[model samples]
Target: MSQPPPAAHHAGHVAVIGRPNVGKSTLVNALVGANVSIVSNRPQTTRHRLLGIASVPGGQLVLVDTPGLHREGGRLASSALNRVLNRAARGALEGVDAAALVVEAGRWDEEDALAYDTLRASGLPVVLVVNQVDRVADKASLLPYLQRINEGREFAALHPVSALKRTGLDALVASLLAQLPEQPPLYGEDEITDRSQRFLAGELVREQLMRQLGAELPYATTVEIESFTEEPSPKAGVMYRIGAVIWVEREGQKAIVIGKGGTRLRDIGKRARERMEQLFDAKVFLQTWVRVREGWSDDESALRSLGYGDS
Candidate 1:
């Protein structure tokens, strides 16, 4: 008789949860080996649940990158941010194999403690991941605290990883793989992420906006892809017609984005166009318009339309 085939491997979901600027997006990008989620120095850069799939020789791991959790006053933007947090808190951990709680090295405080408490309350197998290890000057100083956090708690494992530097990731992946159950893959082996081309394009534009326009401007702005169309060109180039709406709060802010004599808007458009072309691998014609929608973030209907929902 012919030899039987090898047994199939199991796939699992791993939620990367933490407060803002904790390197969660960086970790997801490192694991997926692609820039599926945009990264920046600003806090709360990730506004939604970004699904990145990591496939290995034996199995696959679907990582969910969520927005940071924090307390915000009653406002449409704050409400939307809270919705993203709750979705991951309730959905990602349920029936999942494990969760990696990403924390900043040498920065443990009450907020971090609260996040750890929440993870413990969830009753899922938790792994304490001390991310940004490169930022810490004294690694030995953190060991006592890590030991304290591990004491009396049932953590599947503890890992010190520098997601940005690509340190200790192999061991972390190995630990996650060992914890995963034996079964078939949850997603296609070749699939990397679930985000659409339009969504990724919008996100890339938003990332550029954040990088160019800092501070309150990044938080106040939102990018929405209005139209995307492709046209064949034999001589000039393959043209991709793209339109986006940049939302701001005040008319003055709109003026700033538009710039003096449209210089600023021209720059923004040029940079965004370059990125879109590279992403789609075609020449892109980007058209962007800025609009002032005062208090748009507080509008429930607006929030829902932007893809924030109560779960």
Candidate 2:
């Protein structure tokens, strides 16, 4: 196939919007060919807006991955944190060329509708991304589900894909590129994300916390990088020395993260370091500690200080 001329290429920002835990970050990571955004099974695992840049054959996609949109009134929702997350997600929509409304292959709910409505109000071209089709035992049922979601809704394109498996992405990319305006690449092809390595380091530790602790983990718990230093290494090209502090609401939660005899914390640090080595492609020395923050998640000032502000 003949390559499109440089003047014919399309490049623009696209907001990835969805309800909590619908694999928005996973899709972005798959498209970017890197783990620029953190992923976990927990709802609202993504707390900030980050951009993943994917330079494909026909064009470049600057994907804005945002926190899942959820109602703030639930008992499980921290009013302040929920407000911050919702604001961050909504704020990410500004100046984007298009939006991708992600949803699980077989599921749709009020929150899904809310996300779609929010994007519709923005007046951007939306592409329905039916993600996680690999999880569906009955593939035939997906057609009806897709039709149901499409009812009374207008979308620039729709695709069923498995972000984890990286299937059905070529078509998705082509569809999204058709919606974008023809232009040059907005970023260097080598650039994968807008977030710095320091931010990603903290998120890697938090990903461990969410994956390991599961239901035992408190919503108030967050990872903060106290120190991030890079130094020369004899064997490796670069070495990163990182210090992470896990903040919890109370002493009990701190104990849960630290675990008995500090085994849990060690595992978290070890896994996080391995991931960092992979993502940064450099040796990493990571140290972690758990501390009680009383009520940081609820305090708007503290949340901003911890890097949870609207982005």
Candidate 3:
């Protein structure tokens, strides 16, 4: 007699929440096994919430990667962009089957406390994912830290993982799957994320800008896809023709992004184009320009125009 396959009925959404640089996006990307989210060391790099879908054998897990929480201050003290990003982060938690509070392996901070407070307030079954454990020099030091944090509040599970190195994720996924609701897959196995190729292309450009520029400049910069059109190629079936603007807050910032002889901006465009070609699996003609949208980060309309906080 042929037996039926084991039930893979558990499937649900998991909100990955954390403080800045705690590796929430990295974990989400690693879990989905794709570049569904962009990575950068700069705070506030993820200005929007993202959904990364993963299809396990019996079930599926939707990983919601949100902006890292931080106390508002500094040039961003205007509180407009700050509000929008935090709202995005909070929105990701709504109706999620489970939540993962990511934190550095051996450290805790005020922002981590804020994240924990938010998770506790939600009353959802949470998993404490200690990320970047690979950087923990003293391997034996993690147990006591984990024990102490676990005592702070109840968690459905505690798993130490290195999202960057892809270690211990299998166990983490199994634990997360167990906590999910008994259901079928929400997204098709072939589907990876909710974001469009155009959006990701802009993100890849923004990511390179973030990586190439010094710390302060990345904050002043935001990438906007002015136009993205597709046309049939002579050889290939299709190719993407993209025109984007890198918006900055000031004239001096614009000069910096453009660089001497426009060399820097061209380099940014070249790398971004290469990334887009790989992502779209077709030739990409990426035309990028640096423009001054003074104080766009603080302006509600400018942020909206750039696709922040909108469906």
Candidate 4:
């Protein structure tokens, strides 16, 4: 006799919450099999909740990548960063089937404890993901620390994985799948992320800037996709006209972004154009301009206009 059919399954959302730079973005990229969230060596790189959807055999898992949480309020940028964290904490995890609290292994400290406290208050089923195992000198040494951290919390499971090396991700994916609720897929199976090409193009430029200029430039910079137009190319056969505004805090910063003889800005534009071509699979006509937006991070109205708030 033929066996009964397997039960149909549904997709669910899973928020990857943790302090900044713990490889949360990398994990999301790995899970979704694409570069959905921008990754950089710098901290606080992700300022928004990037949603990446992964399709499993039977269900889909939506991962929400949030900015790293930290103490704030002294400076304008810090205050904005704090607001980002609060928004994620208050609503990002709600209605999700489960959450993966990512922590860097061998670097656990008081900050980790505070993150745990916040997660505990969320009242969501949590899974502890000890990321960056590759960085630890003695992997065995982490077990004792893990035990202590998990002492009081009621976590569904603990997973030690390295997002950079792509180690133990299968197990992490399996654990998340088991905890997901029964529901239909929220997005199409081919869809990987919710961000638009223009938004992603701006992010790509910002990522390159972060790598080249480091913290000195990232916090002071914002990329806005002013216009995105596609038409038949006069020379390249097909052309994507992408316009972006690079905002800086001071005239000096603007000059620096433009660089001597405009070389620096040219480099940034070239790199951004290349990445956009790859992402969109077409030729791109990229135009970038640097403008001074004094204290934009501090101005509530500016922040809201930039989609950093509920404006």
Candidate 5:
């Protein structure tokens, strides 16, 4: 008997949407099997629309990881920055075949509803992803929560998963792939993301900023890669020399990021360099400087200059 022919391949774009801090980036990173998107405990960690390609035996998923959908009226809100982030998230819905509406397991709120509404309005297949299931102490309680949220709502599929631990992802991936059109792969199997290495490098540095600075750091702070260059290395094969500027809205914020005697900045650079080296598979020499930008986050021109307006 002849062996059965290989399964037909499916490929298309799927937007990952959720409120801030709901593990959307983590889910994207897990699905892509790489750190294509940065993750932090802070809300709005992702400020851009990034494509993470996940290739499997029968299908390939082009995952559009987007900024968290959030309200912009809070005291901590940076109006321009928040608008940019929200726009990036909503804009990602355009030209997508499906959407993954991610929310923390056992909880759903107005922002979550907002994300679902946005996806529904696009007329795309919305797959409800209840992420972070590992944190749910009582697995039994999850059924009730899932049922409660599913009431009077429509979803192509629903999955309870833990993006951090990589559990329940196979089913989720299958559900998403099922919704995609049957076609050839959109990208090479080796390709993981559409973003360039330079952009990833800058994001890695910003990840350190959010992780290290926490609440003390201003919400308006952003990272700009002033310079990124590669050189041949005798032992490491390649080396990267990256200069990053940490843009802050106030001179006092600069002092805070710099810390006493520049130690804080040094630690941030050290950690960022380590991450870049790991991600790029090369040696990294990273230099970081904190500078005052005087409300750059709220300034459209400045935001555009700092690479904030892209979708």
Candidate 6:
């Protein structure tokens, strides 16, 4: 098939959607060439839609990392937070130039089917990205897997990738870029993401908390940046002083985040500060406070106060 006419320039949004643990967040970071979203093996790690802008030769690819689509049940999944997240994920598809539905290379499940159906119904240009191929033992297995995926919908293209390994990413980006029309860049070429430094700072701390606490990380726990101040340094660099609070629904959850002698909280702060420093290209002084905001996840107004992507 002949390629579409080349545009002098291009800029468009591409929404990446998948079920939890399918490596959608990892792919966003890889495509952006920077860490714009938090990633973990845990389900629901990405709780909202995030934008990671990648500058290509011809255009900027605004990649939207949508939250994982899961079966909702009980009070937790039905809570105000969950509803907002799910809506935000689906809402991201609106007005996007194209969409990428990521699935594990050798695995298919009910959630994947639901996500596929949702994307098809949206009537957008869809690309099937079979991610995590590095974990697939048999390379030949992808042929049949790709066939099965194609049977469900008419995709623009199919690409198998290992988002964690940065394999086959160039082709995937090329495929999506082909579908976008020419336009001016939406953001500066040097900008990796549209999110604020404060928002990413809070996410880094939450990532550390999730990694450190593991199973003990409360579903209702959230991190908020109260004050983010920057000042000139002697070395002709800006230094950031940030104050943040970790809000938990209960006192016990607060104890888990703070830990004994505040060791865990300190660790979380340290790691988050290091990441912030690298991202901002400056030194960081981060102060984290653990506070009990009882039932914030369940409380509509409280979730609003916590603030997250598009919510």
TM-score of candidate 4 versus the correct structure, residues matched by position: 0.93
Per-residue accuracy of model 5 over 129-208 as CA lDDT, tens digit each: 99999999999999989999999999999999999999999999999999999999999999999999889988998999
Structural RMSD, model 3: 1.4
Candidate 3, residue 99: Cα displacement in angstroms equals: 0.5
Question: Measured by TM-score, how close is model 6 to the native structure?
Answer: 0.94
Give the Cα lDDT of each candidate: 0.78, 0.93, 0.87, 0.82, 0.92, 0.87
Error of 6 at 280 (Å): 0.7
TM-score of each: 0.88, 0.96, 0.96, 0.93, 0.97, 0.94
Q: Which stretches of candidate 6 lie over 4 Å from their true place?
A: 1-7, 309-311
Highest TM-score: give the candidate number.
5
Could you list the CA RMSD of all candidates, in the order they appear? 2.9, 2.0, 1.4, 2.1, 1.2, 3.1
Which of the numbered candidates is closest to the native, going by highest lDDT?
A: 2
The order by descending TM-score is 5, 2, 3, 6, 4, 1
Candidate 1 residue spans exceeding 4 A from truth: 1-8, 72-90, 216-218, 233-239
lDDT per residue (tens digit) for residues 1-311 in model 3 = 99998875788999999998888888998999898888888877787888999887777999988998887777574468888888888888888989999999999888898899999899888888999999999999998998888885888889999999999999999989998989878888999898999899889999889877856464767889999999999986899999988888888888888889999889989988888888778988889988887777787887888899973
The collision pairs in model 1 are: 9-183, 10-183, 76-297, 76-298
Instruction: Give candidate 4 regions above 4 Å deviation.
Output: 76-78, 233-238
In model 5, pairs of residues that clash are none
lDDT of 3 at 174: 90
Error of 4 at 202 (Å): 1.3
User: Which residue segments of model 3 deviate by more than 4 Å?
Assistant: 2-5, 73-78, 216-218
Looking at model 2, which ten-residue stretch has the lowest summed lDDT? Answer: 71-80
Select the stronger candidate by lDDT from 1 and 4: 4
Cα displacement (Å) at residue 263, model 1: 3.2
For candidate 6, the per-residue lDDT at 75 reads: 79
